[model samples]
Target: MRTGAAATYDPFASYADPREPLFTSTVVSVIGNIGMGKSTCMKCLFVLRPLLLGRRVVVLDKKRQGAEGEYGPIARAMGTQPVRLVPGGGPGASCINLIDPRIGIATSSGAATSEGRPAGQLELVQRVIAEYLGHSLDVLGIEALRVALLAAPGRAAADSREPTLLDLIWCLQHPHDGQVRSLYDDSWTAADVYGWGREAAATLLVLANGELGGVIDGPTSPEVSVDHPAGLTVFDISSLPNSGPALGIVMLLIQTWLSGLLAQRSAARQQTILVVEEGWHVSSSASLGEMFREQAKLSRALGLCLVAGFHHPSDLPHGSPARALMKESSTLFLFGQSEEVEVRETLSIAQLPRELGDLIRSLPQGECVLVKAGADPEHVSIGISDWEAAVTNTDAQLTGDAYG
Candidate 1:
C-alpha cells in the first residue's frame, strides 16, 4: 500500500512525519499463529494510520463478531458499521443479490462472441455455479446452465429482471422448448440434458435454501454498499458456516464484488486496499486462488493493494495462488509462530534468515519482524499510543462487552 501526498493520506506520527512517505509497498502479507499478534500487527501496519488519513478500506472480517469484530469497531469509529451477514437471518443480517445485473456486469469481461452478446455473462454463471456448488459441473451441465441463465435475464433485456437460484433451478428441470434439445443431437433426448441440469441445479438450490441461503439468496439487502466513501467495507462472514467449501464460496463472491469496485477506481488512481483475514478459505480453491493471483498481479496498474493474513503458511498450500501472492508481496510482517513446524515453513516461504527462526519462535507479544521484498529485515516493535492500542486490540471482545 503506497502512502504519501500522492495518496492524500497521512502516516502515523510514530512511524513517519506527515511530510514523509511511509509504507510504500503494493502488496503486503502478515503471517503468524493465533494470538501471536497477527491481527494487532496488521492493525498497526495498515488500519490505524491509513483510515485516519481517509483512505477507504475493505476487510473480510472472517472472525464474524458482527459489530464486535477486529475491524468493525474501527470501521464504526470511522463513521460506518461493518455489514454483517448471519445464517437463518437476524436483526442485522445482510443478504447479497447475486442476480443483480450490476453484479453480473461487474464480473463481465467485456468480451463478446460472434452473436454480439457479452461472453462474460456466461462465464460469470459458470463461475458462480462452480464456486457455490463447491465443485465442477459436467460439460452438459455447464452448457445447460449457461442456456438457462441466458434466458434467466431474458435475452432481450437481460438486466430488466433479477433472476434467483430458484429461476435457474426451474429452468434446469423443465426444458425450454428447443433450448434443452439443442444441447444434444437426436442421439440423446431433451430429457438427458434436463437430467444433468436438474442435478447441477439441485446443488445450487442447497446454496439458496440450505445453510447459507439467507446470505446469498434474495433481493440484495440495503445493509451492504460496495461504494462507501468513508473508505471501509467489512463483510462479516464470521457467522456463516466455517465449513471450508461454504466459506470459500462466500469469500469468492465478496472478492468478485470488490474487484468490480477496484476496476472502477482504476481511472481515479485511488489507492484501494483489501485486507482479508483467514484468507486460506479463498486460496484453498485452485480457481479462487488463481483469481486472487490475477487480481494481485493487476493491482499495481489498477492502484490496488491486498493485505492477506492467516494463521500459518499452510493456510496457503504449496503452489496455491495465495502462496504466489506471498512471493509477490513486497511488504511482509512475521509475527511469532508457536509451532516449530509452522515456524520453519513460514520462514522458508518468507525466505528470512535461518538464524532468525529461533528469535521468531520466542518473540514477545506485539513484536514482529518487518521484511520488505529484496531488502534486509527489520525487527520492529509496534508502538501504538495507549488509546490507539486499546482500539486495535482484537481481544476487546474477550475481556468485556465494550468492543461493540
Candidate 2:
C-alpha cells in the first residue's frame, strides 16, 4: 500500500501507479456544509493539481458569488471565460441544441441499444419533460414521445438542418398518416396518435417557446464549443432560476453532450475531470440521478472523472442511483459539518468508522478527512498559495479580502 502524509496525497499520482492502485475508478465525492471550504479543497486538490499533470478540467459552476459565477475568476485566470447560459437566450448568449446530432441521438435502428446513444437521448427527453411536469410520464405519454422523437429527423429534412426541439414538437403536433400507420395498425389514425401526444406537445411547447425557450430549442451557437485550449471549461448556469427544472436540465444536457464528445475521441486522449458543484441538483432528481448512474459506469473507460460536491449526504437519498455512485467513489473528502447528524450520515456513506463523527464535525476550515479506497482515513490540511487564494476565494465580497 502507498503510505504518506494525507496532506501530500495526490490522487493523480496514486491512480496512475499500477502496482498499488488505490482507486478502481476516478470518481471523487466532496461532502461538507456551505462555507466550510469544500469548494476551495476541490479547486486546490482536484482542479489545480490535476491541471499541473496535464489533465483537462471542466466545471459546472452553479454558485454565484456576486455578479458572476464562483469559478469565473479561475476560468479568467486560465485565459478563458466561463460559458454563461442564461434563460430566454438572446443575442450573444451561449446555447446548446437539445437535438444536436453531435450529441449522438441515434437516428437509425442499427445504432439503437439498451445502453447506446438512442436510449440515452430518449431518456434525456423524457427526463426534461418529467422535470417540467413535476412527475414521470405515463405509458402513453412515453410512447408518444418516443415515436415523435424517432420521426423528428425525417420531418426536419425539408428544413436542411438537424432536428431541433421545435422539430420534435412539430412531429408531436402533426403526426403523419404514414408514420402513424407504420407504427400502429390501420385502426390508429393521426388524430388518435396526436391525442396520445397532446400532453407531451403542450409540455414541450413550454421548453421550445415559453420561458425556457431559446437556450435549448434552437441550433447550437457557432461560438459555443466544449474544446478549450486552456483545458479548463466552466459552464455558468447561475443566471437561471434555481427553483425550477431549468438548472437541472442544463446540467444533464451538458453531461450528455460531454459524454458524446468523449465517446468520439480516441482512447489515447488525455483524461477529463468533470466537476459538478452544488451537485444536489443531480442527486435529488430521479432523471438526473439515473443519468449520472449510467455515466458513472462508463466514466473509467471513457477516461473521465466525476468530481461531485454536495452539502450533505442527505442530499443523496438512500438507495438512489446518485447515492450509490457516491458509495462507489474511489476517493472521498469530508470537510467540517456543523451538524452532528450530517457528520454521521457522511461517515456512513463513506463507510468510515462512526467513532470519527465528532472529529469530522469539529474539523476547522481548509482541513478535511481524506478517505481513499483501500486506505485508512487520514486528516488532510490543504495549503493554498497567495495566488490560489486570490483565484479560489468565494468570500471576497463579505471579507473585503481575497481569501475565503
Give the number of the best model, judged by lDDT: 2
Regions of candidate 2 where Cα sits further than 4 Å from its true position: 1-13, 90-92, 106-201, 222-224, 241-244, 279-284, 314-316, 400-404
- What lDDT tens digits, residue by residue, belong to model 2 across residues 85-154? 8888876567788867556443434256542236657777887788788888888878888888888988
Error of 2 at 250 (Å): 2.6
For model 2, the run of ten residues with the poorest summed lDDT: 108-117
**TM accuracy, model 1:** 0.75
**Please, what are the lDDT tens digits per residue for candidate 1 over residues 102-202?**
55544345444543444554555566678766667878888777767655655324556466656667777776666655655466666776776875778
> Model 1, poorest ten-residue lDDT window?
1-10
Question: Number of clashes in model 2?
Answer: 0
Model 1 stretches with alpha carbons more than 4 Å out: 1-25, 64-69, 105-119, 132-163, 167-197, 279-288, 314-317, 338-340
Considering every candidate listed, which one attains the maximal TM-score?
A: 2
lDDT, candidate 1, residue 235?
Answer: 78
